[model samples]
Structures are given as structure tokens and as C-alpha cells.
Target: MALPTFTQRYEAGDAWLANSCAHPTLVQDVWAADMLAPIPSGEEWLVAEARLATGYPKLVRIRAEQRGPVLADPVMDALWWLVPLGAAEELADVRQLVVQAAGWCLNCPPTGWQVEGRMWITRPDGSGLLTDPAVLAAAFGPGGYRLATEASR
Candidate 1:
């Protein structure tokens, strides 16, 4: 299948996130300024955070799922993936993955947008897509085949 272009992804992300929050206008405004806006996790989805060192490889190994949304903060050396609601616990065992469920907020930017060292490495495609925690863990699990292959690359 053909992937969505940046414009498509941007529209999808903007529309989806605008509706996800209580104040749509505020979210829009924040994004217009190229600033990170806080998005609450739990009710809709959870966030799986990992160090750039670990998360980048896993994301590369997975080839970036159509529904998988990922964000990166260069300044923080952190990468975040949006996972299904209640799936945070599933990725808890992955050494560097931090599962942020209810009561946690993720700072996010518009799809295809970067601001203050934060960028959307992968944006939400607006197809109700989310990373599968099980798959993420398996791909990054110790001694996994992908690691050996990726290491040699």
C-alpha cells in the first residue's frame, strides 16, 4: 500500500489530536507555535517511552507500522510510542521502556512537526493505529535475531 504523504499525515494528526483534547482551539494554537502540548494518556492510549539508544533500533526493526505513532525528544534522549489503551503494562518488562498509563501526560507536537528538540519521528496516521506492545518487546528482546542483524549493519 502507498503510504500517506507528509501532508496527509499532518492533516490526520492535526484532526485527531484536535479532537482528543478538551480544548481543541488550545491544542491548535500550541501546535501553530511549534510548541509541545501535553496530551493525557490512558483513556485513549498509553505511552511507551524508551531511551533513544534502545527505542530507535526497535522502531527501525519494525519498519514503522502504519498505525504506530512515535515521538522523539532529542534533548531528553527519549523516544515515545503510542500504544493501545491499557497496553502499557505489556511493555513494562522491556529493559528501557517506560510505560506511562493513566495520570501521565505526554508532550506532543503536530504530525510532521518539530519543536524545541522534539519531533514526530512517526506521526499518528489517524487510522486508530497504535503500536502493539508485544511486538515491540519481542523485536527488542535480548538476543533477538533483529539485534544481531542490526548490529552488523
Candidate 2:
């Protein structure tokens, strides 16, 4: 269940501006370190898939059974979205679309991995956001953005 389209997702409130007011300063800080890069002109911007995930509930997990860079503390903050009624059940579907779309944008095949108690059933290599509701649900827990290193198994 890939997202119908970026347009469709946004229209349905699934597209949150990467730097919108809805995101807290902490979230922005985390996003900056974990998911954004600077354009040639020196302006910073969230990666394409990250931009998409901002509006939609998504996750981005790096798998390969190896940890890469050390994520800065502020960069690991969690951003949680409220799930309105009738939308809770669609978590898996939303995640699938987000994952597929991200994989396409990143020019890679979908890769699945487990994290904590939940599973990052779909993911990419470099940096991208997963859009499934279930993934989001797990990622943004009571505290938010559980460290990949400390995420439950």
C-alpha cells in the first residue's frame, strides 16, 4: 500500500511540512541531525523521504546488523502524531506506502528489519522515512524516539 501520491497524502493531512510549527524545537533539532542535509547554496533541507514522513506517520531504520554513525542526543528526539479515530487500524498500510515510496525515492529495494519490540518491516539504506502507522506507533512511544541502540527487542 504505497502512498497514492504526494499530492493525495498532503490533501489527506498525511503531508506535514518538514519544518512546520507542529514540530517542536527538539524535534526540529533531532530532524536536523538525523535527517537533513544542506543544499549546495548552504541552505538546509530535509531529505525527500523525510519531508514526506513529516506529514505522514513514518519510520526510518538503518539495517545491516551493524550500527553506523553515532547519533547525537538531540538528533534522536521523537516526533509523534496524533492518530484520529478510524485511522488506527491503517498503521500497517500507511507504513507500507511510506516504506515503498521512500525506497523508490532512494533508488533502492525495500529492506525489512526488526527494532526493539516492533519491527521496521520496510526501510532503506542511507536516510529516508518510513510511512507506516504501525512503525510510527512504535517509534513514538511514551518518551519518543527510543534510541536504536536501546530500542527493545
Can you write out model 2's per-residue Cα lDDT over 17-127, one digit (the tens) per residue?
A: 222223334433533444431111101111122233342332344232322111111122322222222333454344322222111111111122122222112222233
Q: For model 2, what is the error of residue 6's alpha carbon versus the real structure, in angstroms, after optimal superposition? A: 19
Q: Report lDDT (CA) for all predictions.
A: 0.78, 0.29
lDDT for residue 48 in candidate 2, whole number 0-100: 21
Worst 10 residues of 1 by lDDT: 142-151
Q: Please report how far candidate 1 places residue 84 from its true position, in Å.
A: 0.4
The TM-scores of all predictions, comma-separated, are 0.85, 0.19
Model 1 TM-score relative to the real fold? 0.85
RMSD values for the candidates in order, in angstroms, are 3.2, 16.1
The residue-by-residue lDDT of candidate 1 on 26-104, one tens digit each, is 8889888878888787767788889987678768777554238888997798998888887766777777788885758
Question: Clash pairs of candidate 2?
Answer: 2-97, 15-55, 16-55, 58-130, 59-130, 94-132, 95-131, 95-132, 116-152
